[model samples]
Target chain A: MSRHRTTRQRGSSANMLMTASASAGDDHSDSAQDPLPSWNEGATKQAIIDFVADVTREDSPHFEPRDRRIAVFDNDGTLWVEQPMYAQMDFALEELRKVLPLHPEWRDRQPFKAAIEADFETLLKEGARNLQILVGALYAGTTPDQFDRLAAEWLAAAVHPRFERRYTELVYQPMREVMAYFRANGFKTFIVTGGGAEFVRAFAEQTYDAPPEEVIGSGIITRFESRDGRADLYRFADVDFVDEGPGKPVGIESHIGRRPIAAFGNSDGDLEMLEYTTGASGRRLGLIVRHTDAAREYAYDKGSPVGHLERALEGASSNGWIIADMRRDWRVIFPFDGA
Target chain B: MSRHRTTRQRGSSANMLMTASASAGDDHSDSAQDPLPSWNEGATKQAIIDFVADVTREDSPHFEPRDRRIAVFDNDGTLWVEQPMYAQMDFALEELRKVLPLHPEWRDRQPFKAAIEADFETLLKEGARNLQILVGALYAGTTPDQFDRLAAEWLAAAVHPRFERRYTELVYQPMREVMAYFRANGFKTFIVTGGGAEFVRAFAEQTYDAPPEEVIGSGIITRFESRDGRADLYRFADVDFVDEGPGKPVGIESHIGRRPIAAFGNSDGDLEMLEYTTGASGRRLGLIVRHTDAAREYAYDKGSPVGHLERALEGASSNGWIIADMRRDWRVIFPFDGA
Candidate 1:
């Protein structure tokens, strides 16, 4: 149902971040033939390619059937930029700005007033509860279809603060290539985000090439109503499920009904998902997209309230998770960036 | 995870139910190639074929893309047998019999007492609550993985009383062919059931060719715990969501995240799913499997407590839903039945 077309043209930009290392063993000189051209040849990149090869090789003991090759990726920091502020937060605040005129009562309300005034301090203090309120207000009265349209429209227009590119264009090219690579190899790629499922579903198909059904995330309860022989679903304010931290594994189990063979995530929120994925009795891969390029992208880790990366960062070595340092591993950040 | 092998043979059976009529418009003469050979020549079969062709044919006004060609089937009655007793209920009772000795309190408990005594009269009066109790007792301390194994073990051994065959073999051959037909046409088939999700997921892939992720149903909350560096999920007695009647649409919306183009159901419990599927603006199809074959299978409609089929049966004509009368539409009942 989410059929939004992306506004940006890929393969036209000439903004390469880093060049491929000549010393690397893999043949990635032929950009047209490279499944992951955006990735610079490195240990991280080789590890990913090797894992895929091992799992897919029919003769290998690590070989997994096509049905069992399920790979889950966290959306926010893993697939796209979540800094400057979470993209969903920016969307919510923008929505609050638009609706503030109608809801005069919100002018005096704590979270609403703080959000309207661009009071980051207060909003951060309130944390997820503030986001929930804003989400409820943003989605009020609109059906999922209508909300999807609004999200798509906003995404088409909204630009990243630093990059000044459309939010959709800011999606990580390497991650996108990884998704496509997995998909090509008969692996089902799913976006297991901590963001709103409906919000991410809006442009997931267009941006990530993952279908709406494959994007599992936090969701609000939707009530089904039939009026005048027309079936409509209404979104409620109550949180149905929160897919973060420990909830990630729960959400994965509920939605996927099986442990993923591989998981790509960024923060501690994804630690459990990584654990669940790699803990299964099979050859599995778990990778963390560590934000370590401040010149190209904001680099914040354990100290950042948005995507805290302490626990998972600490456990990466012990768990054998491939930590992809953006500056070292990725040749290009966004799809708009050139090789 | 659910790698259960069915204990049955494909080509050895010689039992034939009824021969196909010579009046079918489509060529089904090549028995080896007919997509739905077990289906008799009828309006219901024709309608189903026509809808699928219309939706899949390129340049057709009704054509839907491969991704949008999602078809949902109700599990209990629509896909397989649930007449003499709901299969999940039978499994639960069998489990109750196994665990009844451990809990002496159940010996005096109303629902448990009635279940232990094989008091169908009292159990029927108790209704869903009894099943919930039985389910809770059955899955007490077992993790989802453990429960899946238990279910697979039970299904392999369980037999349908009337058919005197494995419950898996008693699956309607016509419906199986229809599922295969839909799948062949690039439609993603899903089992949307009121039965326990875990129970259905155990054999869905093997029996229906529907993966565990494709089977959405009633569920209990699963608690996530990390013990001795191993992640485990324990199923609780708490009801998370019920995928029955009104809840079917909700489950579909939550899991599938889009309206299915086609829906197949057998009872009034699927009324909402049918309405939700057809009410959407699209070329949609809704079909109800009416149990009118007393000679081949059990025949009970409105008065039947197991799968009451009154409201849906009455509304089928007005809703433009196809009613596949089991006795008339189906040439063969079970998979063991011949042409």
Candidate 2:
């Protein structure tokens, strides 16, 4: 936290796309025929449509080259549901319960015990590092196959407490459409998240249509070995890189070698990514998805534990970032709602 | 090196694709009309053809889903000529002369003096670390724009010492065809190189048709900052990640998330990547390029300073890795040499 605490709440995603007179430009010519049907006809929705139209139009001066039309999205809160705690965190807790029999001593361990009892207050008091260590210990040293099987199986079976739906279906319809829209317009969409890289990648391809290669996120160290006439790549418990805040841009540059033209995020964790993305030379969009729907989805800002949107929310206005008010701007919050 | 050091003096690229009897199959009828026309027909050539065919055919048990079709290639000796020193080394030398005026004291330094004097023996003696420090110093702290300008300018003007042609034109024709061949068969081609990523990406798109996003290689730390209402990403003089040997697999997992279906390289540095890629379940191809063509390219093995092909070559036989004999296997070398 101390390594990057300078700009607490001063930057976010931008919106201003160039218009092109190219013959094939904007087939859905007006906001009336907007592709983002899940979004209400508002400034936020308009900004998105305009940005996409401008970038894809060949004649636009601000148009990014097709290969450079990189759109990066934050996974947890921005793309899908991150409420009732992050899905990965939930997965971790569930794993803790399942693995408790194997680790009887974990009942006395601080973070492990806190996790077992679902003591949110104790877990928070114990802090991020302890939680990370516990999670890492739980998931580490497994071959890709073994980890994948466990995660995939858990994901298939696990249902959201409130929605009573499989977590995979928890994805936001608007975001899904946005991804499809970007792909149709030749933009390479990537998920740059603070969550586990492998965790996001496991089901992102099937859900978001963004493949494994396009995902950039936090990861642990991995080792390669040979066994039984086969090579094995397995995960270890050490943090390889943390793809959050300022680290977001670093990860983006390292993996993609190009700054994204568009970035979507919802917390202070995403502030630097928003700044890095929108701060590009020209016509960049930085979007902040403000969770404002308490009825349909949990809405908490400033300091609610999961996805604290304090600094970034305050910063969004200053940067002209589109604060997508979920309550007001989105027509449908979830896929099951059938807008 | 201890992390990954085994096998020597054997293993390189393969060829010979399968017949299109599977449901979702390659349209290319046979190896006689092979897409890799630049490669001389042999088991090595046939093996590559067969692997692509097998993995792409829907009915084949080994068939990879289209999204899982990732093919990684090493840059230096594998895709282009690394002999007479690496092309990047040539770039570094040229940069050294241009920057020598600023660092007159550098003449007293071992690696700097070696670089300034164009003394290959002394430079090699000073070893990789000192040389890396010199090169990192030469390129570091410059904004991505300035560095890009410098690299692109140098690439445009500089000519290969032996070939009297731009270094970009020195890419191997057979390798280029293989990239195209895999791409045609729905495999996404990526460069997983130990060379400087930016240097390769600056010209790779034009020369190899592998865009900046598709190019993965070693990189240094880069910082994103803002001044005069503009953002700049400047490279620092620190090694962020070296995509060499063991580090190659780490980079691939971090960036691409999924194991590549096929891996190609020419040096010991690529051993880990080769193992990581081909070691994955089901059908996988690991190809090594042996620089045995002295007439068209420089011939070196076991102890070449540029790309030492030692342990990897020795271990290839047991691993069933294909050894691409440049002299015997490649009918044509450089693309400029003609069809």
Best by TM-score: 1
Runs with alpha carbons beyond 4 Å of true place in candidate 2? A1-34, A97-132, A226-231, B1-33, B100-132, B226-231
Displacement of the residue B147 alpha carbon in candidate 1, Å: 1.3
Model 1 per-residue lDDT tens digits across residues A1-339: 011111111121111211232111222322345666778988988898888888888888998876688899999899999987888899998877787788899988878888888776687563355666678767876778888888888888898888898887788888877876675565777899888888898888767756677889888888788656576787877778778778888888888887899999999889889988998788999999999999988788988877878999999999899999999999888766653
RMSD of each candidate relative to the true structure: 7.0, 9.0
- Give Cα distance to truth, residue A292, candidate 2, Å: 0.7
Report the number of clashing residue pairs per model: 0, 30
Question: Considering every candidate listed, which one attains the maximal lDDT?
Answer: 1
**For model 2 chain A, where is the 10-residue window of minimal lDDT?**
A1-10
lDDT of 2 by residue, A205-254 (tens): 66665667778887777777666766667777776777777778988887
Assess every candidate by TM-score.
0.88, 0.86
lDDT of predicted model 1: 0.77
The per-residue C-alpha lDDT of model 2 at residue B118 equals 74
- TM-score of candidate 1 chain B vs. the reference: 0.86
